[model samples]
Target: MSAKRGIELEPDLLDQRIKTLAELGDLTGDLVATASRLAERLPRLGTAPPAVHLALRLREAAGSSGLAGEVEATEREVREYKQMLSEAKRKYEEHESQAREDLRAAEESAATAGPDATGRPGSPRRSS
Candidate 1:
């Protein structure tokens, strides 16, 4: 992919990217799950020293706006990117198939049509 040549989509590279995105999605999902479990299993800290307890800090680390939330967001983004890439691949394959079919049809048509079929100037005509 270069700026001067326009988008040169390499199928192998696209497939690799899709695979990487899937792997990242899985890793992020795992992280989110672990963080969620940590957040859920921890007991709420007592009110005496709300901001001073170690448990509170641990809970905050796994809080909704912390590690768990960030990982969840990453997982979602990866899933979305993978889906879009898959759709693009599907469309490209479909278009390639259609183009091949069209080319075959054109060749067949030309083979079946004799030279005089064009009726153009200087084209050989049927001999009576």
Candidate 2:
């Protein structure tokens, strides 16, 4: 492919990857916000004794034991989101590397096909 075409394609691929990373990052942020809200609310749930009592009773009826289990579950979800974020970052880096390679190859090919085939300044070719 021509250097211009390669440059165009690389940007398109990079753009797609950036969009995907942004989406994943947004999802991770939302999950973090949710976990934070839950943590904050978990403490406030203790301030109201009557509500706490009712919540405990409801937890017993629902077979959850207490709010701690829910908190743990949310914590696990947060961990999973972090893992996903790491994976997304790795994939982004890989995409960037591949795009760079593609662009470099295209540039090398273009340069080779141009007039300066030897790519060295002082070399002179023999007559045919």
Candidate 3:
């Protein structure tokens, strides 16, 4: 393909990389939020001396068996999000690397194909 076409492909590849990076960033944010909320709630669940005696009553009122299950679920979600973010980031990096390599190759090809000495292809004639 022509250098121009290769350059065009670079932009499209970069766009895809950007999108994947953005998704990874969003997932990371969600994971952080989930971890923070779970951490905050889990600690409060144990540190609330006043709520100790009322735990059973609150559980009945909330209709949930226990906070452990909920905390575990949140932890699992965070873990999954983290894994997804890692994969997205890895893909983005791979695309970025490929784009860079493609761009460099295209540039080299363009330079080599440009005006040579004597304005001829592969000519060894030196310029004035």
RMSD each, Å: 4.2, 9.4, 10.3
Which 10 residues in a row give candidate 3 its minimum summed lDDT? 60-69
Give lDDT tens digits, candidate 1, residues 7-115: 6677888899999999989998999999998877666566567644767778888877888898898899999999999899989989889999999997778668977
Measured with C-alpha atoms, the lDDT of residue 94 in candidate 3 is 89
Candidate 1 error regions (>4 Å): 1-7, 41-58, 116-128
Ranking by TM-score: 1, 2, 3
Cα lDDT of model 2 overall? 0.60
The prediction achieving the highest lDDT against the true structure is 1
- Of 2 and 3, the candidate ranking higher by TM-score: 2
**60 Cα displacement, candidate 3 (Å):** 8.4
lDDT of 3 by residue, 1-128 (tens): 67756533344555566566667656655664554444344222454666664654554433323443454455566557656755766776789899999999977876777645225566665569
Q: Evaluate residue 11 in candidate 2 and report its C-alpha lDDT on the 0 to 100 scale.
A: 45
Candidate 2, residues 1-128, lDDT tens digits: the string is 77756633344565566566667656665665555444444333564889788665654533333344455465566656656755666776789899999999978886777645646676555568
By the TM-score metric, which is better: model 1 or model 2?
1
Candidate 2 stretches greater than 4 Å from native? 1-65, 115-128
Sorting all predicted structures by lDDT, with the top scorer first, yields 1, 2, 3
Error of 1 at 121 (Å): 11
lDDT of each: 0.84, 0.60, 0.57
